[model samples]
Target: MRYSRILEIVGDIVKVHVPATENKQTAICFGDLALIESIADSARPPHLSQVILLEGEEVSLQVFSGTKGLSTHSVVRFLGRSMEVTFSPNILGRAFSGTGRAIDGGPQLNDEPSIEIDGPTVNPARRVLASHMIRTDVPMIDVFNCLVESQKIPIFSVAGEPYNQLLAQIGTHADADIVVFGGMGLIFDDYYFFRKAFEDAGVLARTVMFVHQGSDPVVEGLLVPDMALAVAERFAVEEGKRVLVLLTDMTAYADALKEVGISMEHVPSNRGYIGDLYSQLARRYEKACDYRGAGSVTILSVTTMPGDDVTHPVPDNTGYITEGQFYLHDGVIDPFGSLSRLKQHVIGKVTREDHSQIMNTMVRFYAAAQDAQQKQAMSFELSEYDHRLLKFGELFQRDFMDINVTMPLEDALDRCWQVLAECFSRDELLMKDSLVEKYFPTPADTLSQVDP
Candidate 1:
């Protein structure tokens, strides 16, 4: 391949001057990987880069490594390929950098074949509509907002919330065959916490982590989601494994895009983000598909809202792409804002016959409890129903809404019944008489049963 000369350099971006005769199809194409080398001094190692923009004979590239001490005389060699990562079962239990290099200090993988990152999604005809649920024993998720298989959802939270803790809990207990984790702009402590948590749970053998710490390159941060989803697709398609992809702090990913976009001199959109923010987010989320006659890929990501602003470009665009979102507030998943759009597909069909009625009733009572608490704060005269609502709220939170509460779906349902029976009489529940007869405890029966 013929080499080109570097025309200019600007903070991790290099503009190479390709000859007019260079083939547009074969050379100087967008997304093509290139190796930049300083010709004046042959000792400097070659830096990897990707073509970000092309204008006639001028091609702009974003160097994974910042351009420092490099002259205009540097030679650029196009690799004729885009970014790729190794895919194999060996990746499980292993940690990799955003660039797909082994960061776990283990032996490098040699037998795995490379798959291109950010490829087109699976065909629509090949995808089956999501019909199953991915149970993560968390009460707010499993009991209320069921996590449907192959559904794309997010945990919308702000800084300082225990979103990471919640994510770790799900990773440790979710019933997926494998978990693919991608952390963007995380601190070293957060990285260590995730690794240690998975290892302690003895689930490292079934987890793959692609971590991009805050200290890593911005370009690397942008690659984490794509790399993670690509490997997940391969596992579901070839191995017939139910895969769950978890991404933390996608807002960091968007920020990386804005940083790179500014360096590339591209026009900005709302909040100074790139114009393709929505498209970029949709491309990644759309990969959550259930392949026909094969396994499935579900995405449960954390798209943190800056200052708890839902109108932020990242979360705003995400709200349109994902099926529904879990609102993590003050270390608890707020059931009011949290919803699963596809939960209806599996509620009664796959779950218990009482699942629908119980979920609605619990939420309705919780709303009433909120009003009762507000009335108490104002020193309003307390009525019998108001007093009962206050009692119901406390028990519901302690037994079910607490993030630390871990129980099976059936147990959670049973616990819900116990809470209702303790606070409200049989006639006030407003539930079906048949369901009440089967699940709700009579006064005599309630005296025999204790807190679960």
Candidate 2:
């Protein structure tokens, strides 16, 4: 409904005083659109802004770009609603900017009507427990740290790392019904790489990207997540499609949030960020859940810490919100730090019989190897056991832990056997006798592989 402009130039925020007295509501939600026109310049285009606050009849709108050039006598029209994003089958095989604008040079989409962003949360009663596994066909993820469906997790990395490559690879390989790509504050090259990679891998047919590049409006970074997730939820619930959402550089998104919060003069909680940081993170994460009888929405995001500092406000707050995180260092997934909290739910149960035993034994020996390295660095005596541990650690890191060593789960487990046998005698493994007899190599075979 159209209303008379009440007050303008209210210190960077335009206040449209209209009687919501007829329509009773608590607060005007984020992403709600408001059209403002300059009364003096009647022919001027409408200054599109979104509702920032609602106090009875007083509703404040934050201009998408800024409130510059907005005068005191501007006509304000509140749509009494938020910005709506279009989602449909046509979204597949297409790419969009952070604001839901087409960027792939594709034709316009007009089939499915759009739904507003900042969608409602899934009812607890309608949410099923997250136990199903979502495999990305990446050894670092599948064999060691399992990714469960509907789980919200982040890849903690640093700048100049291969986090984007990893995310692109997951898009190409993850076994999901649909893929939603949300790129926040991405460079133009990074954005293009995603489009090209998906198209090349043949997954673009099922992928939808919402990008907020470095050159675009900063506010779009905050909108990208909500828009992607809202569409994902609809597909999961309405069409029963398992949607995998990949968001890159969430730290950028957090910074954008902080920027807007500062603009509003909101009080800072931790590190000058808005105090509701945790809740905001949780609200988005909680959206990553499986519907009771429908499809699932799984979230895998990248959170690059400032200077690789996990204790920074963005990653620090995120650590508490996500189920677990994958730590990427030096272009490889670190086994010592990367963790999947729900791994036990799928590991050893759905994976091979040797999965649990091998995963455990590999990490255990690698730890011993780290100790051996320390001792060796300090010129300590290398005990016979220490020598063996050192060799095993080298082999483990080179074989199983190397990011370039791409192999299936069974092959990885078989390689684990090769390492275990090379380092110890049948009697030294401390494994079950029955299993040792089945897996451990004979003396003759050991001499053949382990040359003196």
Candidate 3:
């Protein structure tokens, strides 16, 4: 059905007045797509839009291409459907805009089957417990906080941090069958970096990106996550492929929501964001799931906190919805701030027997190392134990905490033993005697090994 009159033009939103039907039902529902065409100028191309708000006899649509050339004398044609994206094997190795159109300059996917985006999440009864781990070859993650399959977690950081580089590293090394990436408000340099990283690592063939550059319309950024998750859900269910979805800078997404909400004259909540901020974010994060009989979708997103404040609305709300978070700061994943609520499920079951003990002992010693360093800074006379702790701390940061250090899980565990042996005796470990005897390095063994 086509409505001829536009009531208001505010930002990218165009309000149209639609007459009630005989039954007095809504003429158009929210989320439905519409095409807005200028009535006086037929030469202008129609702008694609989505119904964002609906009131009595009035419908508001968000123009994906902005409302610059639009006027009040425009026609709104409802499509009777929500947003959708193409889904097929061909999407692999391709890049798309937030609107689901090809932006990689490759062939269009018009022939592929189009699947509706933002569908309902999987039923709780149909979900399986997340038990398997997704190895990223980063010891800080693989050893300390395992990325359990189907877990939804975020890298909490501030602006100017290496969060994007960490994300790119994970995307390149993660042991998932397919990777679906959503980049919101990314600059051209960052976008090119991700593409080049994947291409150089030879993982682009199994990767798909849906990007909304910084210059794109704000409304488009809101669609990037939905489009990426929609395709990931399809691949997990239909093809039985374990899909890893990476979304960077979700703060940009929330900001986009705030912009649209303000344009619509809605009442603001915290920090001038819409009242349903938590619900809006939960709707996306809850999409991470492990199907009962099929594959799974693990979501790893980046949420930058303003001013490094954990109390910021974006990161605060995300913390509640996600399983846990990786606190990335100073180019390293902070062991104390990072936690994986599901790591217990896989630490011992899927990994080495000493995995759990090594994790606990390493963090405990690192904590003591921090204390020792504080004492040294205070100009207090350091004890012999403190001296050993200081050495261990340096090695810990250099070997495991460094973001650039890459090693397999077993090799990382072995390196942990080597470092411990160099600092303290076997009895100092306080781990299980069985594990200590089996994996602990002896003096002769330590002497035989050369420093890398």
Candidate 4:
């Protein structure tokens, strides 16, 4: 049904007066789509909008294209549906705007199947235990924090860190069958970098991107995650494809929510964000699931903490919803700050026998190395073991901790054994005697492996 009276035009929100009716057919539900048409100027194109707020005889819609060209006299036609995105095999290798319109200049997907966005998450009974791992060939992730299938985790980093590059690396090398990426408030260069990275790695054929640029309408940024997750859910359930969804800079997404909330005159909560921030975020992260008899959807998102403050509302709330987080700092994944709660599920079950032993030993030595370096910095006396620890620390950061280093999990495990042998004796490892005897390098081999 069409309502001719637009009550107010504030920013991108257009409030329309729809009289209350007893009939259920014409009831305006929140999140329903609307078409805003200019009555005086028929030549102007109609703008698509979504109902964000509904009160007695008053309905407010957020226009996707902005409200600069809209007037209070514009007609609002309710579409009786929420937002949706096109879904098909052809959607792979394609890029779409936040509003689900093709922006890559490729053929339009108007004929493809359309699926509704922001639906309820999978039921707990329908989900299976996440026992499988999604290898990204990055030792810090594969070796230390094993990313399990259907896990939802975020990369917590501040601006200026190479979080996007890390995300691109994961997207290119992740073992999942499909990658669905959502970029919120990304600049042109960052967006181009992701596109080129996927194309160069030859993964573009199996990837799909839904992006909202920094200059786009703020309301559009709020839709990118929903659109990307909707497609991922369909692929995992219907096609039985293991889908990995990557969203970058969720802080920008949360900021967009704050902006919309203020525009709608809603009372702000902590840090000027909306009151339902947790609910808004959990609705998306909870979408990660491994279907009992089908495939899975694993979400890895980036949430940049403003001013490097973990207490910031965006990262703070995100920390509660996600299973664990990878703390990215100084261009490396900080071993001490990062945690993967589900790594125990796959450490020895799916990986090499020495996986658990090597992981524990390597991190233990790295911590000692950090302490030894602190002593050296203070100009205190350093013991021979401290000297060995310093050497091990340097090699650890250069070989395994470096984000650019990529290798198979087994090779990484072997490298860990080699590094430990180079720094400390067999007894120093404190690992299982059987594992050390089988995997630890011999004294002669360690000497030969050492660089001259």
| TM-score of each model, in listed order | 0.96, 0.89, 0.98, 0.98
How high is the lDDT of residue 439 in model 1? 95
lDDT: the better of candidates 1 and 2: 1
lDDT of 1 by residue, 1-452 (tens): 64656778887889887777765556556888998888877998988888999888888988876677577878888898899998987899999988888999998886688899968987868789888988899999998999999999999999999999999989998999999999999999999999999999899999999999988877788889999999999999899999999999899999989988988888899989999999999999999999987899999999889988999999999999999999999888999999899999999999999999999999999999999999999999999999999999998888888888888898889888888998887788899999998999777877887776
Please write out the lDDT profile of model 2 over residues 1-452, one tens digit for every residue. 56565665544467777766643543345557878887777877787788877777777777755566677667777676788789778888888877687888988775668987787787867778777888776777887788898889999999998999999988888889999999999999999999999999999999999999998767778889998999899999999999999998888988887877777778888888888888888888789988888999999999998899999998998999898999998888998899999888878677777678777877777888999999999999999999999999888777766565556667667667777888877666666677667766676766676421
lDDT value for candidate 4? 0.92
**Given candidate 4, what's the lDDT at residue 42?**
86
Per-model lDDT: 0.90, 0.82, 0.94, 0.92
Best by lDDT: 3
RMSD of 2: 3.4
- Higher-scoring candidate on lDDT, 2 or 3: 3
lDDT of 3 by residue, 7-31 (tens): 9999988999887681155346679
- Runs in model 3 deviating more than 4 A are 22-27
Higher-scoring candidate on TM-score, 2 or 3: 3
- What would the TM-score be for candidate 1 when compared with the true structure? 0.96
Instruction: Order candidates by lDDT, high to low.
Output: 3, 4, 1, 2
- Which residues of candidate 1, in runs, are more than 4 Å off? 2-4, 24-26, 448-452
